[model samples]
Target: MVHEKSCLIDVPTAEHPRPAAAATLLELMHAQGEVERLSEREQLLSSLLISVNAVLWAIDWETRRVLYVSPAYERVFGRSASLLLADYREWRNSIHPEDLDYAERSLARVLEQGTVEDREYRIITADGQIRWLSDKCYINQQVEPGKPVIVVGIAEDITEKKQLELELHRLATTDVLTQTSNRRHFFECANQAFDTACAQGAPLAFLLLDIDDFKEVNDSYGHLEGDQVLRRIAESGRGILRRGDLFGRIGGEEFAVVLPGCVPEMALLVAERLGKEIQNLSFNYEGQAFGVTISQGLANLTEQDTTLDNLFARADTAMYEAKRLGKNRVLAG
Candidate 1:
């Protein structure tokens, strides 16, 4: 990515013309020679730029053999280009097992539509290392004598970029402390669940949780201690729940969980699991260990519901009832 300065321009030191006409002619000739050399150097640099960084490949349509592969194959695939040239199947084998199906589909679509499909795939090196590769291939539309319609491709290594994108999405959707879904992502997924359940006439449920005496915990200890309690409780909730559940921190001491394809009874069981887990939890904040409990509320999404607010209000009311009835139980409505 770093480069040294190139000598594309040369300036003469003299501010004025030479004393004699012969001297002027000599200066002009020298400048002309420098210009010609630079032009040739530019062409060489262009070739190196493509040869070093880009992977160029060609496939013979009639024989279905790999006709050409640049030397960059070793730099990327950790082996000689001749391996793939001898048999295209070797190249196919190098592709990731999971991505093979997608690549095949794209190839088929290209042959049928005569339009290139831009895609990404995983490649395995000679040392059994995996890398993310991006490919750009288009069909050669022009016809020529004694040659089949060949597919030309150029590829680059984009593993780092892909990793960064995945990391970003994870952070954007997950809570920093407990690694649970944040409020924004939770609502989006829960709404989708509602729509799907409505179309299928399936039942859905909602569970609301609130930490008992959270303010007292923060005041008796400190904000840091309170944060630890929150994290521990959130983690316990996540561990107790199933993958089909949607859990998120909705407020400082409040959380919401959605259960899809679940009725009121199953939802109550799930809420009880979370509450029991929290009651068993012991926090060691600042070396002072203490116990904590949670209150939960459950609601079933009936076919008559129109908006999320309707379900949320019922869950909220039930949670308050649980809190009023001594704070360590699940209240269902």
Candidate 2:
């Protein structure tokens, strides 16, 4: 049989690419013994590779033809070795439509620089949902005049990792009970509103509301029902507000409403409507119907109310007035 001259194997009585060694049987016996351990090492390496969970693949450097695929491909790509033999386009096509452009750009950079590339992309699985994959790729060209420098890539599903990251981000940005903006996110939204107000020379007002008898509810009905009331109030407040307005739970049962590009008159009107909505809401507590209400204070970020603290103080005073004058009415200051 005619073998490629560059074949990586030794032979007898032929032009073997492995260093040509001709000696007596006793001398060759020592050489044969030396290679015995190498066979065991090769088996160990092959066993380790086949058992790995990461999907391993090799593609031709020039034509991008599929050269080798590991058994793990069945778990990730759900395709047989035979299907990916001809070209890499099949795998490329399997990539999520939204991620194709980014994958192409990453691939182009890898080819131009011959540098190792690590990337992630989503792929539609046999199931309908998108599954994310993270990959590490490197060029392997150890042998000279090798059949186009083969690209070796390893991929593993990272969908869980992505989900964890998204959930972490949401936890940071969202209020746990109310699902509205938390204190940290409240500041972020207010900063944007401040920018808008400054750019347009329009007024920005903040309405801070606190449940007058909130602690009583918690002490009487337990924290679980109190939490339910908070969530219901937040949902009802959202219904009354516009899309651009920002509402956040800043403290235990204290919430802040940020209105950008709004005057005193407009803000008072909005606050009054929201106050009644909260009062009318019949907060449910463990299959039991109950009546609950809140007192709110309004403060404008005018020249007089300089800092957030100063503005909040005014709103706090106004809110106490709301409680003093009879709890359910809006105290627009």
Candidate 3:
């Protein structure tokens, strides 16, 4: 049998190249360009991850292994990324004891819910500083089935935000001068206490106190001394009052206390104790020394009392009577 001869084409020289060869060279150049572009993009992403303030982390859910952690982990958590990668428990150890259970449970919820964005907790840094974090985590959708589930999260430092919130609350609810509850906050809390007492038939007492001859003190010793007296009285009241009692600066040179679970007799004792404490306080303006006193009106919850205003009115009347009878004493309404 005769075999057909296979056709052979001449190989192209460097000077005289074939069309296919040129096309292959062009495709190689294009691929090289694409690779360089990819490398540049990867480098840019790495730089961004390093520079960001938040910590980015990925972990194997089943194995409890840290797969990857960004450089920011060291800065934010004050721990090395290498340690975290070696064992995911490093992250747990950093979390505050009070928040550990919550942080873990919230992270686990990502398995069912696919995401948990409102995860906030406190962490103790390696330097022994406590910091707040707003951690948002999610399940990795790209994780292959039968392989360990992957979880990713970003934790942002929220310590400053929490501190600002606390300061704002203090400004809103606290008296700037005495550091006691402000008038609005005092009345709000007092009204709630009054309603609770009325509902449970619990004994409640209200005490209204005014610094005796406060304007005269301000005029005589100057307003600065008057302010000192107010602050001292507030400090004394806070020290003498029961733990559960509510105290506030209600008006100019006036303070009020809400005594829950205190009967008239016990309330009188509290008032007397507070009065004596104030009576003991002495002040000196330049070379001259002076003492201060308070007029207190104590009112107890009564069957006829329907609102805190009722108690306030009766206490106000009694306080005026105390002023009339002579100050530095407690009187019941």
- Among these predictions, the greatest TM-score belongs to 3
Candidate 1 lDDT for residue 229: 89
Q: What does candidate 1's lDDT look like per residue over 47-128, in tens digits? A: 7855776687888766779988876777888877887889888778889999999977776666666666477889888899
- Regions of model 1 farther than 4 Å from truth: 1-51, 61-63, 124-130, 143-147
The model with the greater lDDT, 2 or 3, is: 3
Candidate 3 local lDDT, 103-137, one digit each (tens): 98988889889999999999999999999999999
Select the stronger candidate by lDDT from 1 and 3.
3
Question: Of the pair 1 and 3, which is ahead by TM-score?
Answer: 3
Candidate 1 at 108: error in angstroms?
Answer: 2.5
Worst 10 residues of 2 by lDDT: 12-21
What's the ranking of the predictions by TM-score, best on top?
3, 1, 2
Poorly placed runs, candidate 3 (over 4 Å): 1-39, 98-112, 142-148, 195-203, 242-244, 261-266, 301-306
Question: All candidates: CA RMSD in angstroms?
Answer: 12.7, 10.3, 6.8
Error of 3 at 263 (Å): 5.1
Each prediction's Cα lDDT score? Answer: 0.83, 0.81, 0.94
Off by over 4 Å in 2: 1-46, 60-65, 79-89, 96-100, 116-118, 141-150, 163-174, 179-181, 188-207, 219-222, 237-247, 257-277, 284-288, 295-333
